[model samples]
Target: MRINRLIYHEGKVTNPYSVAPTSHFFGSTSQSDPLFWFVYACGPLPHTRGYLLFGSTLLSGWPVSTVHRKEASRFVPSSVRFFSFHYLSSASSFLHPLKMEFKKPATVLNLANIRQALVRMEDTVVFSFIERSQFYESPSVYAPNKYKIPNFSGSFLDWLLLQNEKTHSLVRRYESPDETPFFPDQLEESFLPSLNYPPVLADYADEVNVNDEIRTVYIEKIVPQIAAKRGDQDENIGSTACADVDCLQALSRRVHFGKFVAEAKFQNEMAHYTNLIRNKDIKGIEEAITDSAVEAKILERLIAKGHAYGTDPTLRYSQNPQSKVQPEAIAKIYKEVVIPLTKKVEVEYLLRRLGDDDEAEAQDPQRKTQLMNRLLSNSLW
Candidate 1:
């Protein structure tokens, strides 16, 4: 079946030209049926009017720029759009400089765009795991008061993380909605000017911080599995804290990405989520947002990435080339911890979504707090 729907996004237009099994850009197919996908965006940028098409088939007659449709070869008058023809398989996809402008909600909030960003983040999370694996568990790094600081009462890692956050906050790291700080209570204001990003989520989006849960699971569940071996290395304590910070931030961003997923899903299916939230159907809301197929694909893709990235490319000819971190273990962490926590954030965000409506009874201060606590407590993974 061919799809010719035009998707309009904040002055931008995306048209999925067609789907066909025989087309060639990149695609997968089974014997019984062939699945194909192609999408292109034509829109305005500050300094350019550009177009980009991503798909398995190169169908002619689609617009390549602000130019009229059907002129795929004709370039735009003032802006030059270079087209990159390539295949994008999970195993062979290469990393490049990706600039996802958040200046507008259109470029930033689209599910397709969000998916691209998430895929890039997987590389980061995997690389961070490999880095941390170079050292032992470094238990001293996490043990409280292991390193004495005059005013600090937490672990060496905590002190380092707080310092890291405070420094980055100056450049407005936390200003980005996807960033959730472990020490949210103490983040300093930015010295830089505000980005004034167009608001994309509900006002209560900031309250959906689950870094507490993310950190707990990372320390108790993930770190041990991915590290070199159990036990602390006194000399490597500092390096360990830094590496652990990277892993936590990557995981935090990935898990908290649920906000974007939830907002996108809620906006796309407002009526369904509205009903679930209005009736306090937590289970139903979770079911509606959950896509088992996508989740499975994510696990499978991550497993491949873990093996691909964790191994040395030069050692391809080596017998039984071992990856620094096990591919299956990465998938397992995502399946059990990352995916569930993301969904939890989605559910919590949706429950309070109606708070945007002034008429909703959830606006009562005490009632809202009590209700959220009760809901969150009962909704444990």
Candidate 2:
């Protein structure tokens, strides 16, 4: 296999016949002319390590180094295969579209990826909470107001949520299987084209939305984690309402992250989950996801994030003179509300594992009882 010699001059590639005019190489990143790209394939001596000679001068930027077989394939584009025989000969097996298909690397939904997302989310949650902490408690935001607007009622938060529905409706953030808005019924239909959220986990959508449970627990249990410190001041209705909306949205995202965790766990231990679901064993499901070791690490990470974000040296002499957010409180929330609720969601979702088509088996009380008894007898629990 042979390709026309590529004459490189003044950072542009030209053919020997001068039939094709000089053109910049696609994605040529170097600033200067005579840029050197370590020749992987596409030259007289393909296997030997050498620089692509640009008019008898060895280009400065390209380093002469041994190229791995795997990396050599990446240097040439499929579109230019006929033009470069060196790449064509090596990658000829890939020429037949029917024989083999090229695809982007798969994004495996696993614990490591989920944990990385959770780590990034910690920053979002902590920062949102910090912003919200500046305002004092205003219970009025959750209550019905006597004054009513054209299409809005309830407190200030209501109007704000309505405004979001009107403006961001086009973006369709709610359509994302990952996102669960606090005001689901109130959300306007999205006008924009829908985009898939982690199409790889499409099956997990039925289990992902634990927003209602998260909102309930957050308002009842997790609010004290931050509100207790910030709520001591006199109420500022506007600020408080804004803060409440921000806090709830951020908190919801953090808690619902359990879906990712659950998906990862299920993928890792499919057999274990299948057995538990078959036996209708809730306790087994809980135990499978519960790892005291991992939970401890998560709690410590959240606490550190809180301290890092909460304490500002410039505010040391302020009248408050205290961290608006407490590390211990953050740690406690994860230990008690966040993790427990997440595990609960996983168990609940697993309980309904049999889809609508399996209604008969899923709904049969007698079948469930027998399975439970059989599992108990076997000491599988």
Best by lDDT: 1
TM-score of 2: 0.60
**How well is each residue in 1-381 modelled by candidate 1, as lDDT tens digits?**
232322211223223232222222222332223322334422232222323333223333331112223332333222322323222111011111123455545444456667778888989998999999899998788888877799989888889999999999999999987788889889999978898876667888888999988888999999999999999888898888899999999999998889988877876666677788989999999999899998898999998999889889988679978899999999999999989999999999988888646235333446545643453333222
Question: Where's the lowest-lDDT run of ten residues in candidate 1?
Answer: 88-97
- Candidate number achieving the greatest TM-score relative to the actual structure: 1
* Candidate 2, 1-381: lDDT as tens digits: 222223222222232222112232222223343434434434222433321321211323322222223333345444443355554333321211111011210222435545666677778777776776666554555556734657665656667766765556568777654566666666676666666443434264544567666656765676655664533344466676667667667766666656656655654565677678888888888888888987888888888788767878787667764666787887787788777876776676666655663345445556645643443332211
lDDT of model number 2 = 0.54
How does each model score on TM-score? 0.74, 0.60
- Count the clashes in each prediction: 2, 0
Error at 152, model 1, angstroms: 0.7
